[model samples]
Target: MEAPVYTALAERWQDQAGLARLAERAERRLREHPHGDLTRWRDALSRLPPVEPSADLDRPDPRLGATAPDLQGLGETLMDLHPWRKGPLVLGGIRIDTEWRSDWKWERVTPYIDLGGARVLDIGCGNGYFGLRMLGAGAELVVGVDPTLLFVMQYLVCRHFGGDLPNYVLPLGIEDLPEGLGGWDAVFSMGVLYHRRNPMRHLRRLRRLLKTGGTLVLETLVLPISRPGDLLVPDGRYARMRNVWAIPGTDRLLGWVNEAGFENARLVDMRPTTTSEQRSTPWMTFESLEQALEPGDGSRTIEGLPAPVRAVIVATA
Candidate 1:
């Protein structure tokens, strides 16, 4: 076996279920969608507004069976150590253990990607794990943009770990994004779209970043159908940590994305990373495990939703 892709982070995470936006079953449904007449959703992709990606989806990993990431690199517990892709990918900066990669970060978003020779952009690239993963898979140029100083610091940390070595670059904000850059093969606005100051407008930028056929992947929380909600105003603390707004449901959210300049986009996956009510804590990040609610490290907390409670989409421009 070529080792797991995100195993390192999986091991270090003290919290097994702090986040709930992305889940595994979504991957299952995505891969098997064709065989099961899930074509309604599958066909929706072609109907989405055509935007050609200036880049390309990273190549699929030979290790993981489907679209899932084999993140076995995240171990070794050195917050500073970067995970590098071995033979298939020549990435070596920060090493990521499966513990870290298996978290909601990789779970929800890693499945629908093909990053070789594509111009990739990671909004709110946090510690830069996902972007690094894209680069390892073969994205020619992976640009990670974030508003925080920690973004730079974490890039350093990832670099210290060789996480920054692959074809990757970290910039400040979208405004800082290099101009004349044609567009992206794909854009992963993952944990940030819901938290934006003006989500619709921000989404337009994401769409604009892609050519007519590019994929725009999004992941966020959703409200139950019974409880229709327009927004999910997080407690002040959560807002302060992320510094943006959040919605309670996926319908309104997806509706807005379509309104911004998309068509036929559909909800493809919904998984519950955790069901904790502690949205007000910093630990609420994908890295937290308040959901497990157990002492000691590596315990897991799970939610009992028949379908994934979180929602993900591969909307097109």
Candidate 2:
């Protein structure tokens, strides 16, 4: 896939010396990590017909332009990049019903955070779906970081149709970002905290990424507990996700946030994930929420862990 332009840094990050270095580091990482499927994804992106990019981002599906004349060919090319995880994007008259009805999650998050003219960092941002929504909600620039090459390629596809807006998905993980560059207006860590072995360190790093009084919007799997500091360290995989390390109670997470030096940490929204919100679709035919949970019992995973009940927490740095 072609490297996305990192010009968004020029707008606000020009004053931060490290952000220029960050742009260079991101470029180097993209150049060095030559994913084996890069050529295939590039070909898929190339197949899209050239058209003026037009988008309506303030919608559930985030419509992009109109139907291509060769709709079947357009759909086929998009299908070449499969396993779409984080969107229900509509582009070129094709509605990609992704594995996750991410719009539903966005709806829950939108009311809690204000992105107006803010620079944001979205960790584990899959396909830049939320980044697009952030821009639609008035964010000036959204610098998304995700290590998954497939997700990065998927973002390039979105950019192809959505035009080169301020939404950028860099093929770099949160750890790849340079230290001491803390001036983000808002930082988001969604569906990422549980995967970290050192949750406190993760929280601290998130704090460091934001400027003073910057907002941190965090969403992650949470379990209810009778007392603060209670945590669930799954002996093995929870809900078939191997990388999930810990699921904390909302109170425990808030405590961690406070200990990380964030102020006014509070839970904004909490809800159980349902099959309707995340399920197998034509665009992502692999097993999803349905297969991950125990048969007939929706409240628990097949492994008998509490089913994925996510919580959104907001705090100020």
Candidate 3:
């Protein structure tokens, strides 16, 4: 049986042939990358009580539904999906304090763009948190793509209470997107650029997915460099993440955005990531920002590299 996400996509995104095929491909991809604990996760999802709660996505912690009868049991079931990274969601009266205070990042980006009735594409969207925020900001539709199956399941947990909103999170990577698929009003690639080995190619791909004059919101780690074209190709692991391949200076990032066919690319926000923004919580008990930084000095990573300073760049495609 097809998931509700695919069913919703078949109806809401029926006008787009590419999205239709994408829905099919996404199912196949999930089948290929099946997780061992998927059954357990599904069982927990099945255990959720039938309650269609009202959602308030505009708040710092997106509030969903009121306090239910079996609040303690509900919280335990939700705990089955551990390590919640992107949110501090209030679901069915239980507060899920996630690893990252994603609200701060959202606040930084919201003032720069207008999502009123816009069609959005969010690359590397973890459990559709920003997608919900986009809907709250008046977006018509939000299609989020991420490779992590765990995040997809987390999104399902949210959907259990939030109902079938327009915010859909597909378990697919940016590379899995159909080539030449354009016409998005806005495209957001947050905390994803540095992970790509080829940053320029990734930026170009984001450009190809946007309509002419569409908005591109790119957020990624950066180094403090003097030159416009300078970037750091980390020799080894940076911030305990092996997949991070490139860390560009803000100027170099803007230069690459302009080179990749985006017009008027400019940096809008820049701030060093702090422990307060990303720390170990009950929902996400794993090592966090504090562990990644140097023991005595938070100014540098454990590997002696400069600490993570993320920059948000906005451009016209």
Cα lDDT tens digits, model 2, 32-99, are: 77788877887897899886687889888897766788989998999899989988898877899999
RMSD score of candidate 2 (Å): 1.9
Q: TM per model?
A: 0.56, 0.95, 0.96
Order of candidate numbers by lDDT, starting with the best: 3, 2, 1
* lDDT on C-alpha atoms for all candidate structures: 0.48, 0.87, 0.88
lDDT of 3 by residue, 146-180 (tens): 98999998988788788778888899999999984
lDDT tens readout by residue for model 1, 1-317: 21222223213222433111111222222343334333432232223222221212243211211211322322222222222211121122222232232234454566666666776667766656566567657766555665544334334433432421433324346654434343567887766665667777788888887768888887765655555455656555341244536655777877887887866687878655452322222112244434333333212223222222457877777
Return the TM-score for candidate 2, rounded to 2 decimals.
Answer: 0.95
> Which portions of model 2 show Cα errors greater than 4 Å?
1-4, 225-229
Evaluated at residue 221, the lDDT of candidate 3 is 94
lDDT of 3 at 136: 92
- Pairs of residues at least 3 apart in sequence or in different chains that clash in candidate 3: none
Poorest 10 consecutive residues by lDDT, candidate 1: 18-27
Higher-TM-score candidate among 2 and 3? 3
- What does each candidate score in C-alpha RMSD? 17.5, 1.9, 1.7
